[model samples]
Target: MFDWRELLLRNQPQASQTDDTTLKMLEEQLLDLLPPIVSALNAIANLPIEPTWFQSEIAQKFKLMLEGVEQQYLVAWNHVRNAQIQKLEEEYRIWYQAQLRSDKSLYRTYCQWQDLLIQQHAQGWFSWILLGLKEHPFPASELKKGHSFAPETELLLAEFFRCAKPLIQTDTYAVLKNFYSFQAIFTHQSPFLPQLVQGISNSSEKEISEKLEDNEFVEAAKIFWDILIVEN
Candidate 1:
């Protein structure tokens, strides 16, 4: 299990002593360094990695890749040291909002929002990223409000229904709207009722995935609009 937290915490000492301005620069530099390191590790981990089977140059390249990962670790350490908690919270808020609007499926909307809340409590790295991005730091009292990344209320469900009105079939609209109303309860951790889950789940997944995977989102939206024209 690649525990991101463990990797981060273990490297904290190196980052803490680093200057703030240097931190962002270090992160950018290390981001570039991750690919080759990941590639080498992937190659070795995919064994049987017979070092002798490779030419001298190939073996040397693999060794260099491991060294690059080590170097990137140092950069990551600097990022941890200079991490701004306030900035992270802001980033999480932005990401959460973006994800909610992007998620066409009710299931995904529920899952992503729930995950955001859980991650908020755990003080995950992404949470820290959000906190650090906050432009103006507030008092500790405001910090509580700022850090809160819980899902929006049922009013949001009403908004979703309003937005989805034209796209979904009117005959089944009430049934689908009722499903979104139960957002607070539908959790990824538990097994849902087979029939209820299967009914909504199947249609939503196919439609949402197709819409998203299609590069032309506007074109897809137009297709839905054309359905309205045909129905009229």
Candidate 2:
């Protein structure tokens, strides 16, 4: 684990150091912290399975650590640069806000990537069922009210559902909203299918509402999956 406190302590100013030296030391410490934090996060992401809370928890910690480093830098700057305290604080505030936004954007991208992995796995199950290698490979409990399968199929379906349950929630509206927002920013980005985007644009709220009301969950899942892949 990366120890933010250890890094801070290691980089603390020496009593005999001049103001310029202290300022330079603080700047160097701030630069050094970024690489180690990024490397640790990358290692964490490569784990086969992460605890559900780990990413968010680490993100929060990283943010706090960066804020602490920035505060230390500002203190050094005040001692060495003779800048007005109010102006310096305001400048740091603006820079911190921008940095925080950048960090949030990176976290959101990580989450979106994780969702893509889950959707890809779900799509593999869809492909397996379509090939008749499995008959009804989703749980009866999760299916439409009248739907049922053989005992063996039910067993397989139950196991599969247990593994996929976390990713099974309906996200059509959310996916579409993300897709449009992303498209707005990256207008020239290649789409999975232009026709698909047009079709979604043409779809009405009532049609989507009916699909959810009628328990057409598989169709809804496919729509959400399509939007995810296309936007990716």
Superposed on all Cα atoms, the candidates' RMSDs to the truth, in angstroms, are 20.2, 17.1
For all candidates in order, the CA lDDT equals: 0.37, 0.43
lDDT of 1 at 96: 37
- Give each model a TM-score: 0.23, 0.25
Q: What is the lDDT of candidate 1?
A: 0.37
Worst 10 contiguous positions by lDDT, candidate 1: 46-55
Q: Model 2 — TM-score against the truth?
A: 0.25
Task: Report the lDDT tens digits of candidate 1 across residue range 16-78.
Answer: 776767655555544443443344434332221222332234435555634544554544454
Cα distance off (Å), candidate 2, residue 13: 5.5
